[model samples]
Target: MTTHEPVQMLSARLALPLVRELRGLGHDPAPILKELGLHEAGLRPLEARMALASWLRLHAASIELSSDPAAPARAAARIQPDAFPIPLHLLGSQATVREGWRFSAPYLGVGIDGLRAELIPEETRSRFDFQVQGAPLGPAPLAEFFMVGLFAYGKRVIPSELLPDRVNFAHPRPAHADALCKFIPCTLRFGSRSVGFEFPTAWLDLPIRGADPQLGQLLAEQAAAWLSTHEPTPRLADRVRLWLARNLRDSDAVASRLARDMKLSERTLRRKLSEEGTSIRELVAKARQARASELLGSTSAPLDAIAFELGFSSVGAFCRAFKRWTGCSPARYRAEL
Candidate 1:
């Protein structure tokens, strides 16, 4: 059996708090869930899993409905550690931030494939790296949520005032600069290589106030059992498809760039894809086709704009590609929708 690609599934527990918070804020969660072809029943059991594509759509939809651009960040700050499906009590029971991360980081992948956190020790400070491995389509909300969520969850276990002294994002600065300031109290930086946080290394060794070593042991055992079943062993083709979706806007994002992003060489990437009986070009075409269908059906974005988003230099070029892919023009596709 192959390693399940993280993109194929996302923990159902991830989206509900955001949805409920939105409902509490007076926005209907029904439209966004329906748009993503998800329903309340699917998110019923917090431990249940949902498609990664649908999870991305859920965050995107929440941002759309939240007129405030910093809404995701605000919602993330409000996340309670106790509510997470995975046992975060394990972290709280640990002695220090470093100990907690050593125990927690590996299992986090089981929750959200696209969101990975790295705890790096530096001379004077520690870096907490957050990233979405592939294409960075509409990244503001997710990035904000992930960064803010980390701090929110950390605040629960770490004794002192635990806040990021500096926060950075791989994506561009959002238009709602003032709102991000008002909502998230951190000093924010944008347009970096990855989303990350920097805080004093001293915080890493600071003793956790209420460590429950006994309960921690029990939870760790349970988590190990849980992970044995939920290992992140994604298939090669599915992983490629996800990468393609992430970089659809960059027309020049070919195999070499993709390989480098995935920390594989060009040769390895090719060998892996071929082993699965698909090539980079074929998988990328699949990504564009899926994206085109999504935009055409759900959004009223103009044909030219959609063309640019799909990385076509001109509307004519996009139209031709769309025709080749679906035997129809973008306009016709949208009209049929």
Candidate 2:
């Protein structure tokens, strides 16, 4: 995503499990990593922000590799947010799903710009809408992931088993619908307007098992501090990419211009970037890919305009380059978001 979009990170909290799950099913994960251009090292850092492109490709590869239509739901149903509690501790501190949902803003926003999680509370019932950001992806896997993940997570923290009164999905039911009963034991409805859970409002106030008022206050303060200082002092390559993103609208987005902006000779810039295992051209492309994903994922910007904004001469040119970078055309990429 662009610097302007919500900050996104790939907590092994979700990513590693998909890879491990695939392995558990007797599939190799090496090809999945290679297809997505990710290293085993990238998954090691729990707090590291993954490339959105890689994240998307990883999901696609997992589903394809495992040949499991229900991979997404099972992956989410099994993820334990409490294991990586930098932000989840924020949710665990709350007394109710309603309050927990509200406190989850920072965590969800930072982690999930590709999907939207909303809680609509009424006098008698509440709606938790987990809508995909763009058009439907796959069997609309994330829809199952989020809806089941939330309930599974709640069941972990609350003293009693917490089940949604019912569920709704934007996608039509797949052949594997029967398996959903094992994941979510609730009234399930498919072909709805959105994917989410519906429950009585009374449960919103149900006490979480280990909530502490003092700890809540402490974690809140810590989250605030972490957010403020989280963006680290940029390394040489990161600074170069930032400069490229900011200047992509201008035609002066080449390495000479980047070198000048960094107050270095082109040769020195090249050497420095080589040390970082990237080139100016590679950095520029990375920036453009990220900005492109941000524009498509969050806005209804025209393709030609986004192309121009990324310094492409025309929509055709942008489409070609984006496909090379991501293996999908701009429209296809946007549609699958």
lDDT of each: 0.70, 0.68
TM-score of every prediction relative to native: 0.61, 0.56
Q: How many residue pairs clash in each candidate?
A: 8, 0
Worst 10 residues of 2 by lDDT: 130-139
Error of 2 at 12 (Å): 5.1
Tell me model 1's lDDT, rounded to 2 decimals.
Answer: 0.70
Top model number, lDDT = 1
| Tens-digit lDDT track of model 1 for 1-337 | 7885434566677677678767877988898888877777677564577776776676766677776566666777778653464545666677876787777665665566544565655567666665444433225665666667767777766667766777777777878766776545778877754467777788888887688878778767766776687765656766776567667888875877889987899899989989978888888776777667656754677888888878778889888988998898888877864
Residue 101, model 1: lDDT of 70
Candidate 1, TM-score vs. the true structure? Answer: 0.61
